[model samples]
Target chain A: MNEEIVRLEDAWVHFDGVSVLEEVDLSINQYDFLGIIGPNGGGKTTLLKVILGLLKPSRGKVTVFGHTPEKGRKFVGYVPQYSLFDRDFPVSIWDVVLMGRLEHKKRFKRFSEEDKKLAYDALETVEMLDFKDAQIGKLSGGQQQRVFIARALVAEPKLLLLDEPMASVDSPMQTELYELFEKLRQRMAIVLVSHDISAVSIYVDKIACLNRRLFYHDSKELTAEDLEATYQCPVEIIAHGVPHRVLKEHK
Target chain B: MIEILQYEFMRNALIAALLASIACGIIGVYVVVKRIVFISGGIAHAAFGGIGLGYFLGVNPVLGVIPFSIAAALSMGIIGRRTKIPEDTAIGILWVMGMALGVIFVALSPGYAPELFGYLFGSILTVPTSDIILMLSLNAAIIAVVFSLHREFQAISFDEEYATTIGLPTERLYLLLLCLIALTVVLLIRVVGVILVIALLTIPAAISRQFTHRLSSMMFLSVFLCAILTICGLWLSYAFDLPSGATIVLVSGTAFILSTVSKSIHISVFSKSI
Candidate 1:
């Protein structure tokens, strides 16, 4: 079996005693492409934070690469949900991508030639090398998303956690991005989180639904019960390509 | 103008302004980009408490500011992050409280407070050589810290959650930035006074933001702009017999308005040409 990249055993999180993530269990293996879809405010970000060890779980065990989340997070690349909160923050695309190399960089030392080479490769992979010196905010929303993906890829991480990468991107770039993710999953595990269930369902190998509680299936298909329980309401899911139903109308 | 250099007080004032520029240029970029102008202002005013403590204790008020402002920075940083109170509310509370404490401390002192007006309105001409030495060292320390941690600072200022995912200690880095602001308040207390420190801390960086896409270059431009403006303000004050602090802030504020206006005009013209 491939290396276990992430494992959660009944993890729970509460902010001010309001349960955000309730008793969740999940696992991901190397090179696994998992998609998590849910409504907004449904603990998606909180779960990502828990895995990154930015927030501690109130109860239960969560580990990445078998190490505690804090120590293990160095091997993860995170593309945050917000494209760039402060677009006019005066950072160039090159600077944004190079931030991925910061974990490998030592104090009082400059980014090595190899680090720069990796960033160069990452930008090239995303076809954004031409705009390396452009200010990050000046780009269109699709271009910004690609640059963020490049930033995440620069670190050569074992696991890439993309929170809503398609949230702001238009449909055409969405296909291009998903195709890129397919190529990327050959080397590393990719976990794509979003509210658009059909888009995530099309490209990923496995699917999970998360509200306060997480309903995960080891395979790609999700049962109707899973959809209703996760959304807490009836769901009608129409996929992007050829006519398909993620959730058929329940009797 | 060149003849004024021969006067020791004038020379000292220029030196103080130059020293103040270093802090303003480097830390000011973060202040502007992070939108923490009010927090820096809060730190500046809360420093009045320390000035009062110095008066009550009969020591150098600048020395009193060092500890008092650091304490205030840490308190505000902690409470604002950890508690339920909105950050601006926290700042507003501490801002007036510091001034109130300073007022009471001065009122309770044994004799009439003579240097009080200078602390409030700035008296750059009267800055002791001792204060210059202090500003020089403080400038050195601020530079060293910024040089070492600039990468982390850039990361947090850009995207704090991502910085934390990479294990850069974002909270500590943020608090350290505030502490740097506190130290800067000390440096500027002798230049612009507490009330006007925000002007020097923000205007130069805001103007520099218009011209640069890189953080390092932004700092360089901001420092240059601030030094020139403060000197121009100093000269105007010296020639016209005006208040130095208000003059300095007005000079920078005018430049900020001009740069912003020019930028808008340039954009509109460029779009039309295109």
Candidate 2:
């Protein structure tokens, strides 16, 4: 085993006496690009929250890098869904990205040159270097998501979790984002919760179908039978490389 | 003016203005940025219960208000986070209940207390030396906390969910921020009174935010604006024999309106020229 980075054993989660996740067991290796796909109200987002230590599982255990989820949070970076930011807030993209360095520095100490360089480097990775001085709210939806990714990358974490990173983006931007994710996959383990199942299936190393339980699939050899079983509905799996599509078969 | 300074009360009032302006400016930045102006107002009004309790128990009003205000702040944070009730509704309920409790306590107290009026409408001219010292110390503490947690506070304000995933204890930070707000409200109650403290806390910061993009610059500009307004209001009150709290609020309110008007004009003219 290539040193599992994340291990969840029989993880169970309940909200308001209703089980959101039941007996979910998963293990992610280092540098694994994992895609979690399901319909709305499925437990995909909840699973990411559990891995990020934002929500504790009701039963079972979750370990990341041989430590508890809470202790391992410093090694995890997160990009949340679209936020409703006030347009009048007076903060620049540079200031927002530098906030990622707070956990590494002392409370009273000023940020060092190393921290500034890291923030700039992260922004450059997302191709947002020119807009570093711009106010965050002035950016478009795609640009704001990129800036959020930059903020997460500034922390230099081993694992990155993204919740619906491409929901509001246009088609070209979505393609560009997937390309960026391809480049990011080389250095960090990525767990993305996306509604675009066919598009993500082309790039992800593995896929997990979550709708109250785990339905694992190997992306390299995904079959129509697996698709139907995972979705609990008849699905015709068409074999095209990029921008793949899934159609339901009529009886 | 020199003769006014010769009086102990005038000197104390000046010191109160200096300290309270700095404290309010710093806390005001967070209040404005967080969009919690009404919540801070609710806290200030709720602090009246503390004052009434102090009078009823024959204790220092400042000491008495601390616990009551902190309790109210905690409840605000808890109910606002955990319940489906809108935050504004909760704030309204707490604000009215606090004042009613204060009135009931005062009416039922052993003897009629005349000092309650000063607490209600403010008496800058009656500020004592000890209260001035307390205000100065509180201002220092508020400045220290804000500066030390500048980055974390920014992160939390921007995206609290992302902050938590990156290992920042956002809930604890939020609670700490509410506590700081409560402390600032208590420190400022003497200068502007509870009724007018929210104006002093929000107006200068809101105006300063229009001219700056950095948090530190906003803080500096707000403090300078507040200090100047406090001095100008005091002078006006002294010259015209007006209520100091109302004068101070009017001064800050005018500044807010002027800033808004200038901002609109600048945008329109620039757009036309372009």
Candidate 3:
């Protein structure tokens, strides 16, 4: 029932001699929903990129399904952070979502009927099937996230990686997405990086606190000391700033 | 217009316009969407070096542009992506360096470059059969490359990082796209001249973008628009005794202004069906 999907060993990343990740080691298994919580600029996005092989770590090793990051990334679906691209880009939701099946298809070959069906079903799963013909840029922010999520799901990935998935989504939409993730986790391992601790505590089976380093546990409860170490701040401020339910278990 | 078809120069000019339009119509979409107009302009200006190299070597300058501009394109693509030097800054330097080299190469040649102005501002009416053949070949190459690899091009233009994550060799594809742009610049040189090549490259795609949401439609419409505008400009220049390249650019400019103004006034009369 338990098989390892991702493993990072003694990973250290430095950008121009400035350390972004320090001695971060993590292991994710099948059916695991691991949430990484951290402060702004806490290297959460960097960690995800390293896993995707987009950013090569300065030191240490990372393996996905026991293969190199680049080769194994075909089985990993990624939903990047909210809104880094041009909103005025001239691409339709259907075309953008269909790109998810590209790695599965041969170079220069057309998308097959099954590929279209999977993309359609993925859009339907995210309730964005109605906007298939609409330009991706014409949609609102939350709508765009759903489209990207649908793209991630269309590939039938063994591992799903999302960065800042909840950043700009509204409250109701956030709950919908969390529920969507809950359903998705049974089929694939899910790893989401967010600064929000409350949702992680509530939804994820395991939680990790990351600043420059990583500290995680099997249970959702993160000790106050872990939050302090990650945030480089006091527990009192976290209790005040975060939802009361988040720190209740810690206290 | 019917009588003009009998004249070989007129016929050649018209064919050149169609060929040039096809090249721009396809490559221009990537240029506009990727917002790499400056680098394109650099590639165009850098072809002047190739033009100069042709004069100095006593070969057809258009032929010289093939290798020269490809080199320019590869350099711009690689240096911009691989090195820390800012892309625009690199383009600026290369753009002027090529132009300077062109001047020097022509100066060193034995005789006066009689048709240099034609290459500068364009005299499409004087386009020879040899150059037309070259243009035809270049256009074919451009079409073949784009026809097969446009999906990858679209992927990079829409989101380069995402393209990389999905395991596309984004850097290599980008360089190939630049090479296509270089080839397009070669075809366009005869129709619009080096000075005005960027206009022909941009205006058609920019106009077509207003009315379409899909990439394929945008490309198709863009090619159609390029052909119409270039022919109109050529006719106007022929009838009124004006410089053909400048005339074509101005006509495209006017069409753009008109299209934008009409759309803004709630005329949305033309449905975006395409």
Candidate 4:
């Protein structure tokens, strides 16, 4: 197996002639738990989109698993931010997770027993096996988030990309999610993008600051200067306990 | 009701209702769940252009409708997705344009259009055996496509972005769904006509959704409900010598209202008990 999971060489993305991301060069490796911290509209989501092959980078090349993103996306599991879709859609948690096996399915074939087992295993991995038959809409925000994660994991992806997985989660449960990610990191490469810097930094193995351009750091020792550069202001990282604060008083 | 079924026209109408329900029961779930009722409405109305073109060109209206409505659906799908035009605006433009084209084609053809009212408001009582065959085939197509692509449709309907990330061909699946909707619209046009088609395409499924949270159960319940409503409406229309199409729509509407009222009452009762 290739050690390198994703490589972006000077990736650039723009919409309507406006640059959303610029010269972002980064590579993700196996067993890498990368957290991307950026302000809103800093192309964090766009970066993920580029990796998923949803959007083509305007200027540079992006590869996942040494292939084009489209082909490479087969090995990637993605959990988009919660609340981006209609929760009222009639689907059980089992069915939602079964969607992860879509690419693995052959044409004109219904899901096999193996697919069902994988879906169940994915649900179990997220500790949602009890709710497998429950309607997706009936779950709480955090539960739904976990179900979405299970949906991504059902395919047993080698690379996992999540966008703001902690946004809808309650503060009390946020650490639990990070712990889940920590477990997940043991098996696959994980890239998480969020503006919730204070809570995310502790869990990530490496941290990358993004603000249109990216400042890639190989380790989790992110400095206040890097935070200032990403947020475009003076910053601080107060690591007291569960609720660490990455932003400080301006004065 | 037994006596009513003895008449050929009544029997055809009943068969037509059943066929329409099958298509509606399956397709309507997607419409209501995805909230694409407006797009379905647009397709229904656009099918009028096909009907008019059939008359003008001296071809079978149903055959004309298949291509015309499909073309309309493809255009709506592509333009709404690709162009900067807002989706609703594209639907509206295609909708009115289709209706206008129908009117123009009908005007250009010779003779007064007596069946035009049937196409606009439906004449289930006058349905021929040939149209019955068409509806049966369309129902088969709908069932086969839906069953084969059930998972893909579910994924895209729930979260298109996530579906894309999972390597599902979301755009193609979306277009295929639009095409299915177009076929369903054609199936509905014969039962309720263009103006009232959306009701048949959405009401039963909407009602079913209130009772069940699973897609398959919702589909089964909607189909059952639609059949009951269509048959009841047909019987009432036969007894009263009223318009069958309008009667069916009224029955469905009444059912929807009743479901809503009962749900509210149930909620209130539960709250009081709590």
Candidate 5:
């Protein structure tokens, strides 16, 4: 097996005295594509934030590539949920991609040719090279998500963390993005947070069910029994590969 | 115009206008982008404490406003970072405290407080050469720092969390930005005074943001707008026998309203075409 890229041991998070994540334990391997799915308010976003070092775990430790998340920040790229960004912000796609190289550039020095080349390559990977100078706000939802993916790729990170990459995208774009993710998994590990269990189930090698606590599945094929055990509810895996029964009955 | 330049005071005032315009225009971008107009206003008003201190000590008031304004800006940055307290609340507290301190100090000063009124309303017409030089160097330093850290600033301004994920030192960048804002506020006080400086720092940039989509272009447009507004305000003040700071703010406000209205119309027309 490849080296463990992320190891979280009993991580806990609380907000304003309310327990959000409770005793969560998980491990991600190098080049692993891990999908995280749960209902709303199930601490999916918080878990990603904890792994990104944006929030401190209330208990236990989170190690990314054998170092603290903060120390390993440069080695990981992140695409936060699209909702957090005010798309109206004035910045071009090239400028947004250039931000990915900020850590590498020296103070007062302009971006080198090598940096621009890397940015262009990343843009090409996401099929956004033609929109290099386009304003970020003007892009379609899928296009914006792709640009953000390119921004993350520009860093050449060992691990890529995505939050709901498919939320607002059209169905065809979602399929294309999943294909892109499949290609990306060849180069780096990815931990994607999504509510669309069926869509991600085929692309992800493993799944982690989160609802304050975590239930880990090491196999790509998850059954109704697995969903029931993870969610602690009577869940039925519909024939279409979606856990629709689980959502409907649980609600 | 030649006759106006012949007077030493007029030359000093023009130089001060040039320096103040550049500083305010650059720092104003950050203020507008960050939506920290209230914090900037707090810093400006809080510098009154330093002015009062300078009056009590019989020292240069501009020197006094620097440390006081910087302290206020730093505190605002820190408080906003550390606590979930609404930034507006923190700024309001500091704003009142600083102004109260300034008023008390001025009241306790031994001599008649003739200079206090001038500082409050601004006396650009009587600016000295030394103040002009100071303003010039400060503006140069701000421009150099901003230019050097252009990409980092753009990243942070666009999305602070993404900037951090990319390994940019967001905390340091934010502090540096606040310090620059403090420095700019000090220089601009000579032209717009504390009461009206926020408008000078915000109106032009706010208007320019409507017409540009690039950071560099927005900065350039803001500077041009600010320069035009300053020159027009000065001329209008001369002709109308009005307060320079008030005139400048009024002109910028008018420009902002016009830009906003035209932008809305243009967007509506474009949407209809699409």
Candidate 6:
């Protein structure tokens, strides 16, 4: 059996007495590419935060690599939603990517040669080695997203979590990013939250449709009932030849 | 002009200026890059309350400001984080309340404090040897803390959520940064006065940012530029018989305008040619 990299048992999260996630039992394996699909403000980010140890679940247990989230998080790489940062912040691609090695260095210590090699290797994995010297803001949206991925990857984590990775990328670049993730999931467990259901269904090994509660299936195939269960309305799930899941107007 | 260095007071003022510049240059980059100019201003003004309390209590105002400003910085950090009060509103309240407290304390101090104006609008010439030593110690502490936590600071400043997700103790680091800013405020209050501290803290870093994309380079350039500004302003003030602190800030202000305007012009010209 593949090892469980992350396990959340009966997890519940609440903000200001309003429940965001309830009884979300999830288990991610060593090679799982799990796509989490949900509406805006539907506890997706809260779940991600819980898994990353940034927020504690109100109840239940969350263990990563058989340890508490805090201790286990060092082996996890995170690519947050891209809108929270100052785009014009004065940092080069090299500097931004090297930030991933923060946990590995001692106080007042310079980056080790091994750290440098890992950073460059991560950048190369994202095919961004050539632009390592460029300012981050100077890159296109797709390119900046790739740099963020490189930053996350530089730590060589066992699990990878990304929130809205395609939010700013152009439509054409979205497939390329998925392909990159496809390549990455071969080495580590990948969990991504995205609104792009069609591409997610095609590329991910499993899909978790979440609202306040979770309706998880361990395969890309989903019934119309799963769509309605998550969206809270009657909806159609149309599968095209491109391996996409298109939603029809509510009846 | 060279003979100015021969005077004891002149020598103290020069050394004071160098120490103050070191504090501003190092912490000022964080201030500018993090876009916390107003927050730093709020901390500086709130520090005036400590000065006033010191005078009211018959002790050193600098001593009073140390704890007072740290308290203010911490409360500001807490209020900004835990409450629904808009950060700008909270800063404004703290800024004015701090000054109001200072005024009340000074009014209650029972004597005419003539040197109060020197605290508001600094006179570098009046900085004594003891205060210079205090500033030097503060500079050393700032360098030490920043050196040890440079990566954490950079991470939090750039992407705090990402930093937290990676299990970095971001909240504690942020509060520590505020404390450092508090100390930096103390170092600058004697050089630029409470009224002009933010200008000294921000202008040189802003200028250095135009030439460097890295934080370390920005700090080094800011340190150099601040030294130049302080020395030239001191000379000009001596030559014209003007206020040294205000003159130094004005010089920096003028340079800020020139750098910003020239940058815009360069960008436009390059785009037009492109």
For every model in order, what is the number of clashing pairs?
A: 0, 0, 0, 0, 0, 0
- Shares of reference contacts reproduced by the candidates, in order, are 0.76, 0.82, 0.73, 0.93, 0.76, 0.84
Question: Quick one: best lDDT, which candidate?
Answer: 1
For residues B1-274, could you state the per-residue lDDT of candidate 2 as single tens digits? 7787888888888888888888787889989998888889898999999888888888878877889888888788778877988888888999988888888777777887987877887778889888887887878888888888878888787767777777777888887888888998888888888788898889999999999877778888998898899888888899899988789889889989998999999999999998
**What would the per-residue lDDT of candidate 5 be over residues B182-259, giving only the tens digit for each residue?**
899889888888888898889988988888888888888888888889878877887799988788888889888888
**Model 4 lDDT tens row, B1-274:** 6877788998899999999999899999998998888988999999999999998998778788899899999899899999999989999999999999999999999887789998988888899999999999999999999999988888889888888887888889988999999998888887889899999998999999999889999999999999999899888888898888899999999999999999999999999999
Angstrom error of the Cα, residue B37, model 3: value is: 0.8
**Where does model 2 exceed 4 Å of error?**
A198-201, A220-251, B1-8, B78-94
Cα lDDT computed for each candidate against the true fold: 0.90, 0.83, 0.89, 0.89, 0.85, 0.88
Docking class of 4: high
TM-score of 5: 0.95
What ordering of candidates by DockQ runs from best to worst? 4, 1, 3, 5, 6, 2
TM-score of each model's chain B: 0.98, 0.95, 0.96, 0.98, 0.95, 0.97
Interface RMSD of each: 1.0, 1.6, 1.0, 0.9, 1.2, 1.4
By the DockQ metric, which is better: model 3 or model 5? 3
Q: Write the per-residue lDDT of candidate 6 for residues B1-274, one digit (tens) a residue.
A: 7788899999999999999999999999999998889999999999999999999999979999999999999888889987989888888999999999999999999889888998898879988899998998999999999988888899898988888877677888888998999999999888889999999899999999998888899999999999989888888899999998899999999999999999999999999998
Across A1-251, the per-residue lDDT of candidate 4 in tens digits comes to 53888999999998999999999999999989898989988998999999999999999999999899999998899999776987788888888888889888885699889999999888888899999889888898888889988988888899999999888789877878888998898889999999877657577778889999898767766667778889999866656663443333345
lDDT for model 6, please: 0.88
Q: What are the models' TM-scores?
A: 0.96, 0.89, 0.95, 0.96, 0.95, 0.93
Evaluated on CA atoms against the true complex, candidate 2 attains a DockQ of 0.63
Q: Which structure is stronger by TM-score: 2 or 5?
A: 5
Model 5, residue A192: distance off in Å is 0.7
Clash pairs for candidate 1? none
Question: By TM-score, how accurate is candidate 2?
Answer: 0.89
Worst 10 residues of 3 chain A by lDDT: A242-251
Give residue A221's lDDT in candidate 5 (0 to 100): 50
| Residue A69, model 3, lDDT | 94
